[model samples]
Each structure stands twice: as C-alpha cells, then as structure tokens.
Target: MKNHYCVIMSGGIGSRFWPASRSSYPKQFLDFFGTGRSLIQQTFDRIKKIVPVENIFVVTNQRYNELTLEQLPELKPEQILLEPCRRNTAPCIAYAAHHIHAINPNASMVVAPSDHLILKEDEFLNSLSNGLDFVSKHDVLLTLGIKPNRPETGYGYIQASHQSLDGFTKVKAFTEKPNLELAKVFLESGDFYW
Candidate 1:
C-alpha cells in the first residue's frame, strides 16, 4: 500500500474567536479547554495513529513557525512548510502537494482542518479510514463534512447522497445555515447536526 500522507491546514487566524485567538497565538496553539495539550498538539497525536510521523506535514505561516516548532518539537524542519504570506488554502495545499508528489509519485494525501470537534471517536475514525481507503485508489478530492445539528448561522451544511462507498456517503449538495424556522425544521428532521 502507498503511504498515506496528511497535510494539516493550521494557518487560519480565527478572527471570530477574538481576544483568545490572536494572530500571534492562534486557537490551534492555545489549550482552551485546559487539556494540557494544545489543539495542534492534540491533532498530531490523533493523526499519528494512521499516518507516520514523517508522512504528516504541517503548513503554517512564516510568523507562526517558531510557535509550531516550540509545541511540536518532534517534527523536523522539512516537515513544516512555512509560507511567507497568507495565500489561503489553495496555495498552501498546492505547494505541499507538489513537494509531496515529487517525493512520492503515488502519494495519497488528506487535508484536514486542525480545530474541528468530533464527539463520536469511533464514527470519526471509520469515516477517516473510509476516506483514506477511497483516496488510495481514486484520483479525487475528499473532505469530511459534519451534519448540521442546529440552524445556526455559523456553519454550512452538507446534503448527503444515498450512495455509499465503503460506508462513506457522497455529498450531493451543500446548504447554507438557515434562519431560526428553517433550522428548526432541520432539527425536527434529525438529518443534520453541527
């Protein structure tokens, strides 16, 4: 099997989080819940189970390089790709992809958000395994979307298709967070969760 690689997207400044999440110290580096381990530290521990320490890469802004290093001392310098400016996800993924692709032509990678909260560990792991398995043989972009639990205006919704591949559902369409009434209907339907 080809080595499964993961590129964690940890470059966001998280403006909504406000006072706690500053540009200098983003949420991923903060231990908001007093878990002793910061969010980024927790992420590394979780992903290491499936991907090797060497195969997992972290891409962040040049400014946060030292902070990331301070937190994740196990990582070598090459494993962290530091960007000079905030070019957004596309450029960051592109740069990392090109480098990884050059090193391993048959590489299959998963790009994930660093600050997501998943309640069900088993379900999340199953979905992750399914995604990694599917991507190994398929040349397609894959992202795992959570169901909208409430009609909150904060997040987007994924409309899943009936089709299932290795227990993974395909996203038929996406719905923006609706108003109170619409969100109520979604909750009543029990089809989505946030």
Candidate 2:
C-alpha cells in the first residue's frame, strides 16, 4: 500500500445515460444499480482494498468537485484533482499520473473509470495484482483487456500480438467503435478484446 495509488476518473457527463445522469450530477454520483452506494463510491471501495485510503485520488472537473466531495467524503481536498475544463479521460489520467509521480516517484498506479460494474471481485483483484506485479519488474505500460462475451460495438477493441509475457499479450492495435460487421469479425478472430 505504501507505493500503490489508485486514480478514479469521474469527470464524464454521461450524456448517453441522461435523465438518470446529468451534467450537474453525473452517473458516478448516482446508484444506477440501486446498491446503496454510488458508482464512484463503489469504485473507491474496491480500489481501497489494494490501495491505502490516503493514496487514492479522484480526477474530476471543477464543476463536479462538490459532487465528488459528497460521494467521497473520506478524501482530502488535495486527493481530488480538479480539471479546469473537460478534456476527456486521457488528460485526466495524465494529470493524475503526474501528480502521483511528483509525490512518490516509485508509485505504481491504477487508473480506472468511476462508473463500471465488476461482479467478480476476487477475479478482478487477482488480475490487478498480477498486472501490478508484472509492471513492478518491467519497463512497460500494461493494460487489462476484457475478453468480449458478445459483439460489443460500444467499446473499443484491442488487438493482441502473438507474443505473451507474464500472461499479458502485447497490444498490436486499438480499434475504436467499429461497425457491426467489423465487430463480428473481431469476435470471431479470437485475438481481440474490449
């Protein structure tokens, strides 16, 4: 826990899931599953098992600062990295990574979305542990890819190379929101994952 850091990205407006999710109060602040805890709270809870409470950070827009605070009251103000404007997940992650690296150069961080559902807790943690272990000893950027159970056109696809190291395949390419036909081909290839 000393060197482990978790960054939860919670700046999305969730326009697709509107009505239940709005700009003022995004989906991360709502319990979409009616599980008592909001999405951000659930994400924080899961990551806290592996990361210390103080080491966890939330990256959100300045507008959503109050919402983030309301959802995650345990976090200090500094733990919440507020972006001046919405620049998507890449910039948010980069900001969090820079902040964490400045504090602890040896830190290995996990950047995750605030609104995601993980039903298999044990498996998820085990995979995360494996990835962390792999990265600790190697100079590489590791990303966990989920094997597609269906032709999911909504999510981007990662094409894996033939080589495998520490149970992780090299990402050959990334395809974004492919058409239905291309999605079917990816599913049948047995090499792509969402």
CA lDDT, every model vs. true structure: 0.79, 0.89
Please give the TM-score that candidate 1 achieves against the real structure: 0.84
Q: Encode model 2's per-residue lDDT on 15-102: one tens digit a residue.
A: 8888888888888888988889999999999988888999999999888888788889999989999987888978888999999999
Window of ten residues with lowest summed lDDT in model 1? 147-156
For residue 139, give model 1's deviation from the true position in Å.
2.8
Error of 2 at 161 (Å): 1.2
Q: How well does candidate 1 score on lDDT at residue 113?
A: 70
Q: Top TM-score: which candidate number?
A: 2
How much is the lDDT of residue 148 in candidate 1? 59
Task: After superposing candidate 2 on the true structure, give the runs of residues whose Cα lies further than 4 Å from its correct spot.
Answer: none
Runs in model 1 deviating more than 4 A are: 175-194
